[model samples]
Target: MKITVQLFARARDLAGAEHVELDVPAPGRVADLKRSLASRFPQVSPLVPSLLVAVGTDYANDQTQLSPDVAVACFPPVSGG
Candidate 1:
């Protein structure tokens, strides 16, 4: 499955791009995406655990299933004073 991922804040900085296209297996899961991102973008490895993943407009968990046409958004954990 090929999915387009939108990177936000720290994720965007780590990836050096606002968006990235990833080619995953036909039946892919959020866990797969996490691993792939870490391997492909080493700078993002540390942040993967804390990333907030959204499949479309809804938040998704690690086991969430993914499709080729779906778009995923990754946001680093946010903190406000």
Candidate 2:
């Protein structure tokens, strides 16, 4: 399955793209997507440890299940005053 991921903040800059497509098997987990991202875009891999990943509208953990068509977005964890 192919998943379109929207990049934001630092992740977007590191990847040099606002969006990227990743190949994943159906019924994949958030961890799977992270691995694929690292493999395909090494520049963005460093953020994985602190990256925030969202599936649909909620922030998801490594084990969260995802469908191919779900809305996925990734960005470095945010901090505000």
Candidate 3:
């Protein structure tokens, strides 16, 4: 399955891309996607642990299943000075 992931802030900078398309196994979970992302973009690996993933409008956990029809957004933790 192919999933489109949206990158923001530091994640976009680390990936050097605003968006990325990943090919994962069928019925892949968010955790699986994370692993794939980390593998493909080593620069983003350190930030992956702090990143938040959203499926559609709702936030998702590692176990959340991914759907090709839906896009996933990856957000880096926000810090306000």
Candidate 4:
């Protein structure tokens, strides 16, 4: 399955790109994709625990199931007042 992952804020800076295309296996969850990303980009691995994921426009849990057709985003916590 191929998914487009968008990175934001500090995650984007660390990853050195705003988005990336990932080829994940069938039946993979968000967490699995995260792990794969960390392996591929070791520089960003340390920040994984502080990251949040979104499926389409909604926040997603680490265990959330993913489909190839869905749009996903990975980012650090957003802050505002």
1-81, model 4: which lDDT tens digit per residue?
888899998888888999888777879899988987787678889989988999989999988999988999998888979
Local error of candidate 1 at residue 12 (angstroms): 0.3
TM-score to true structure, per model: 0.92, 0.92, 0.93, 0.91
Q: Global lDDT of each model?
A: 0.89, 0.90, 0.91, 0.87
Ranking by TM-score: 3, 2, 1, 4
Could you tell me the lDDT of residue 29 within candidate 3?
95
- For candidate 2, write residues 52-81 as lDDT tens digits: 999888999999988876999988988778
In the range 1-81, model 3's lDDT, one tens digit per residue, is 999999999999989999999887889999999998999999999998988999988999999988899879998887879
Q: In terms of TM-score, how similar is model 3 to the real structure?
A: 0.93
Q: What is the Å distance of residue 81 in model 3 from its true position? A: 8.5
Instruction: Rank all candidate structures by their lDDT, best first, as comma-separated numbers.
Output: 3, 2, 1, 4
Number of clashes in every candidate structure? 1, 0, 0, 0
Candidate 4: clashing residue pairs, number:
0
Query: Candidate 1 regions off by >4 Å?
Result: none
What is the alpha-carbon lDDT of model 2 when measured against the actual structure? 0.90
12-69: candidate 1 lDDT, tens digit per residue: 9989999998877769999899888888899999998888899999999988999987
